[model samples]
Target chain A: MTLLSFFNYWVVIILMMVGFYCVIARGNMVKKIMGLNLFQTSVFILFVSAGKIVGGSTPILRDGVEVYSNPLPHVIVLTAIVVGVAITAVGLALAVRIQEAYGTIEDDHLRDDFDEEDD
Target chain B: MSPNELFDLLILALLIVCALAIARTKDLAAAVILFSVYSFALCLLWVHRGAPDVAMTEAAVGAGVTAVLFFYTLTRTGRREK
Candidate 1:
């Protein structure tokens, strides 16, 4: 494999880890969502990168063109972007409600509030 | 290795380091900021991979819109107690 290709793969992997770490370790709802976004973005990057072909043109069908980077990844990314935005919107709305219901957004604090109410 | 390869590696290392820091941070805002960094790094990676459209989406939605949403939520909610 070429050095450039090697670098791209490693970068995507590294970014993925970072996003996962944030989602898993952070205590706040918003931070968790941010991590989730990062994770999804990294995945999108991975898909797009995997679809690339050296010296390939846009996936438009053309005369005498035998090689083209897969357009499937591009279409997938577009769909994913829309989904990600929708998720973020819903998550934010949930966060707002959580704030109203518990007067706090922190996961630990929200849990504590729930326990107090249960008691 | 070529300069481009070296740069990519460096960016990858930075992305990992930022992610680790985000995970370790107790402050929610800081974690979100680190997450944005991770997203931005991934956007660059996508561009390098020749997916400019995907990279653009990542930059705009992942790093921009999502980060703003996170910050908005953080400001709306209180921090965890000690």
Candidate 2:
């Protein structure tokens, strides 16, 4: 297969990089959560794309369809999606608590507060 | 390329754009909305890849419930990044 044939994987890599950057470089707690979601979705796409078969139909059985895409990856991604949402909810709840405790959700300010507490 | 390949390329392009926009936007609420758009584009890609069941779950949970959670958090924590 040519390089172009693997375009989906290339997109996944780009997306993964973007999400990684957001998580590491951003300071806003909510933005970090968004970045984590972005990263997780890219992974989901990777698995689903890997499972696709050319000239295949959906996993449902039918009269004339001879091949169906692998259903295992789809099942895995479905569970991951649900778990990802739960993670997001928990992360946001933590952000709310952080805001309540610290009065700001910016990472630098939180660090400064910690420094003050130490001294 | 055939039409199917071309369509796949288009959706992937949209996904990348949505992701970049989410990373670049300063407004937390706008980023949340962009994330929903990204999730919907992903769901479309899942459908195109012949996994309607996963696509349905993504549409309902990824684009629907998650966005609401983000919005509720935004209301509590505030919207500006700084």
> Against the true structure, whose TM-score is highest?
2
The residue-level lDDT of candidate 1 at A118 comes to 100
lDDT (10s digit) by residue, model 1, range B1-82: 6675676677767777876776667777777777788778877766665666777887888789877877777777743322
Among these predictions, the greatest lDDT belongs to 2
Stretches of candidate 2 above 4 Å error?
A: none
CA lDDT, candidate 2, residue A119: 100
Q: For model 1, what is the error of residue B60's alpha carbon versus the real structure, in angstroms, after optimal superposition? A: 2.3
- Model 2 per-residue lDDT at B52: 100
What TM value does chain A in model 1 reach? Answer: 0.87
lDDT of 1 at B75: 71
Q: Name the TM-score of candidate 1.
A: 0.78
RMSD of each: 3.4, 1.0
lDDT of 2 by residue, A40-107 (tens): 98898889888899879999987988899999999999899889988999999999999999999999
Q: For residues B1-82, what per-residue lDDT tens digits would candidate 2 score against the true structure?
A: 7788888889999999999999998999999889889888988899999999999999999889999999999998889987
Look at candidate 1 and tell me the lDDT of residue B51. 67
